[model samples]
Target: MNQTRRKRRPDPSLSRLDSLSPEMLFPAKSPSLTSSRIRYIFLLLTFCFIIYIIFSYGTTFRREQISSIARSLSVFSTRRRHLLFSIAASHDSWLRRSSYVRLWYSPESTRAVVFLDRGGLESDLTLPPVIVSKDVSRFPYNFPGGLRSAIRVARVVKETVDLGDKDVRWFVFGDDDTVFFVDNLVTVLSKYDHRKWYYVGSNSEFYDQNVRYSFDMAFGGGGFAISASLAKVLAKVLDSCLMRYSHMYGSDSRIFSCVAELGVTLTHEPGFHQIDVRGNIFGLLCAHPLSPLVSLHHLDAVDPFFPKRNRTESVAHLIGAASFDSARILQQSVCYDSLNTVTVSVVWGYAVQVYEGNKLLPDLLTLQKTFSTWRRGSGVQSNYMFSTREYPRDPCGRPLVFFLDSVGSDGTEGTWSNYNLHRVGNCHRAEAVERLERVRVLSRKLKHDVEQMVAPRRQCCDISSPYNKSMVINIRQCMPDELIAMNT
Candidate 1:
């Protein structure tokens, strides 16, 4: 029995050592130590993830906070009633005037005053607007047929001011082609008291002919606003003033000259855009502005402001979208294109296609990658592209970085890829490359121009006001030559 037991036990060294598992044999580790190592790795990963999240969403958070505060304070709420006058030509095709007329014909249209040419079926037709004929007998001043409309401006001012609604604080005037963002206009006017005489408007000098007019003159096409007090003063004296400037080349310059006689200088407001360009102004509209966009003129020739195939639908859509918070829209909306060619950046939640005249040579993907890496390294957080779901896809068929995708019920958010038909197509690679290069160059230049426009600005007219040295500065009035000389 003893011999059999010894055989079963075997040699202690060989049996115990050889039969034991590797873990047991090699100095059994503390279970606590293994758990501690795992904990350490988990903590490191968690910290990294937190940092990434903060970096991505910090700006968006701050922007939203600012917007919330502004809304809470009711900075945009104004008790004053505003009256808008849309000047229209009688002979112009209905199609040409239809868009602008229909634009103001909303609940807001109740406040608008529309003037049409006399002796036509178009003039006789009743619309939503407060219809008024461009009656020659309304005022005594009439020079040439060309200046006939110009002569009527004072009459319109007189008619509006005479209505004597104490609530009416502002009288705005614009061409038939002008499109007003009513909310923004109200915000701008709220900064000034209606009791004081204020002539607010923007200037234009893209053309050499613009130099012929007073540098201080506000372009009428861009639209101009007058305080109630000033409108009253003008109502009494405008006919006399018109007689003096009857020979002036343009109505806007003549009006400016007349206002100068009344000791009221043009209060340059950059929000009003006089878009005199013949082609699409997508870039100009999409770029950041020094102030809230109040109006856009000359919509007759440019591409529709919104992203609809039908021009009429685009205008209607734009008017509808204008009801939201302008500041929040500007900050939150981000748009980009895949052709890497033209990128339509959203300024105030509005984007217009921007094409470049010159082509640059750079790999768009490479630039994007570089920018991403730099942003990460710098710890700059971005939540411009958001996904509520665990997994998000780019439907626009564009590179993931281009535009933001809409958050949906399916637990995912992505761009509407079907909308970008041109991007995913089998277009010529060479052409695509060329266009992309142009876009790169234009984007860089546009960025620089925007920076310059928004930099610490001092107005030529407001020398008493301290020069601001902030990133978000108002558009300061400078000599017309300054803007005219720019290659942009």
Candidate 2:
């Protein structure tokens, strides 16, 4: 015992258990280990986020690039792009034989909204919602006769601005009689930027008041394009400017006056024809200027472009030639005097015209006939100058001439030697040569331009790619090759 009894040796297992500490059973956590695990998790999440961004951005870039390519290749776009047609129609005229029938069937109908007079909404229960003048209290002033229509101009500008769809780059205004080449319209608009204010249309000098109001005023009957930015500016300030131009002759003049304040000038495009005369427009369309044929106004007064043909036939005939090679057809088929009193009808590219002045062959050749032939061996050789170099003068002014295609034994077509044997008048020949040279230069330039438009180099997206049904049809009609390639 304390005895001095020696303590028994402790059991080894019991001793070990008793000696164990809390620190040995459960180890303390390391700060570095916890931080390493957190770092691994953060890296994984960042990698996933980066992958998502790449996928999204890559898809968008590819799509944008493809669309740009498509637009650049074709003259007309498939997307209903660029124009908002504002049609001016009277309540009585909307359902009339001359207006509604043509308007309903037109490609512009869907994009167009008819602006009618007060109480016009109630006239026909079947009609769609139309804009009326009475509602626009902003520019509330009226005048007599045709001038009363000017009030609607301010209202249309205001309402269209209020609508404010950025996609609508142009605000096109026209009378009900106007026949639009919607495809040509988009093609024309593609040439300009809508961000800058622009007033695009043609002028009319048939009326005395046209020059009196402003020489720059665009004839509304022929239709006009107001750039979206310019339209917005007009919407805001037009009401204020109306009072100053109250005495203006027509809506076109009023609009001209308003835009002039903002330093916007008219961009005259001759393709838009205001054919004020009442007759057949076959001659006019055939001889249309170098620009894309935009519209033919006063259709109600004139016979259709192809009077004998129906809608389908006439459209087919006009579509391709009108969009791509209008100038070529014009040069070949159209023959008219300066007074427009004498016109030749060239059917299937063959016709003959006999003009008479007081004396012999007249020097005034308004629409001269063009003929071309290549030399047998020379590449791209033309005998046009030789054939037109001399003209035999008859006392009775009877000069029998071959008009079209002729071939020689040497496999050369249109050789100058095959036609005229006699040499006579110098003045007429010199005049003809000068005219031919001018036409030749114009033709070369046109061909170059058309080639550039149809098969342009693949470049970065410069213009917008918008679509419309009408535009699609036009593009198909005009530039089928590009359209096919784009889809493929």
Candidate 3:
């Protein structure tokens, strides 16, 4: 009867629930704990985000560093594509000298621009593209007897840089008559880092010329190379440099003065020959320095490189052998025949000299003065940069000389070069030496790595007894501790 009085027995579950806190009872919508829970979640999310950002950035930086290292160590090889040739020439000389350019310049592989004083009908597709140099009349030239063209020629460095060629590493400059052994040039240039400033070339062979100009100057006729990085900086400041060096004698002197201002000195690469001497260069070519033959200049001023051939023919002849093994071209390899008391000097791809008696290596290295001084003078003016021994006046007294006749690749890494005896006269030669009419040189194609190029050692040669009027000589890498002497 009394629903109101029906104090229902207190349910244990209801009592327990009634005694619990609201936060515990209604857990999902509890406001008191919401703020702290949100704060904890926010802190956790922030920490994760920070870690993610740091990891992402660190990963990118590490990847970039590794990529840079790989590029430097693996992909930074210097090749022909890295070189840009800037040939200085006049309209008058280009016609005659273009032959020399043709010998080395390859349109498909070699990048070059010939800066002529004026544009001519240079329609030959085989030659390098010709561009007329900008007017240099604004610059002053005060050298007493020097041509004003020196200013124009010196500006070729700037002009070449303005060309905006992409991926260039070096800018090589030379006279029109300069004949480049392009393959060897690439090898020599690969020895240096293109990212740094380098002025690589050699001085004139004539002592007086070096004194008059500078021992540090790179004779333009011989050719020189400027690293692209330095060339760009030099281009911006060359005009001011030219104005200051107006009294300089030649274009090379102007370039040298400008480079000196930039704190760059000549890195003498003995391979670039400023053949300042006139007449026969047989002696010079026979005793080439223990380096790759890079270039030859003043061909027109000197006699034909080979006797009985015209100048162009002789150069083509040399290039013919160069096409086979450019690194070995004109490389001197001395080997002695101890049993016969004979010494043989093989100018690979060029000539061979067979001597009757054993000649000292140092003596063979000295250039014979077969050519006259650059200038007709006595004493200091006649001096040369290299050591010289008097070339016998009589041809009969000289060693039996043989010139390159033909060369062929053996299809394996080796080549065979046949050198025919260059008969001077009926000289009294040792029967053994007289019997040989040809020299057959067997050698592998020279492939120099960076280490070999940096620390080059002369190659060793082995000589065989003469047979059938022919002598066989094999050229190979020198063994450890091997000596290039009579006894060795």
| Model 2 per-residue lDDT tens digits across residues 241-296 | 77776665567777778888989889987667666554444334433444666776
Candidate 2's error at 29, in angstroms?
51
**Considering every candidate listed, which one attains the maximal TM-score?**
3
Question: Residue 424 in model 1: shift from native, Å?
Answer: 9.0
What are the per-residue Cα lDDT tens digits for candidate 1 across 1-488? 45544345556688577677544544335653365666676699899999998778779897998898875554334542455454544445444675675664555334665665544444323443444554655444444555566666545666666667655677888777777777667767777666678999977624333555666778888899988778888878867766676676566776677788889998888788776554444434434344766887777666664443455665555555444333222221222223333322223334312222222211211111111111233544322111111111332333211111111122232111101112434434323232331111001001112344346231221111221211111112356554211122
Clashing pairs in 2: 1-4, 1-5, 78-467, 79-466, 79-467, 79-468, 80-467, 80-468, 81-467
For residue 178, give model 2's deviation from the true position in Å: 0.7
List candidate 3 stretches off by more than 4 Å.
1-57, 74-76, 378-380, 466-468
Q: How close is candidate 2 to the true structure, as a TM-score?
A: 0.51
Which candidate number has the best lDDT?
3
Predictions in order: lDDT: 0.50, 0.49, 0.89
After the best TM-score superposition of candidate 1, give how far the Cα of residue 261 lies from its true spot, in angstroms: 0.6
* Full candidate order by lDDT, most accurate first: 3, 1, 2
Whichever of 2 and 3 has more TM-score, that candidate is 3
Candidate 3 global CA lDDT score: 0.89
Give the clash total for candidate 1. 10
TM-score of each: 0.54, 0.51, 0.86
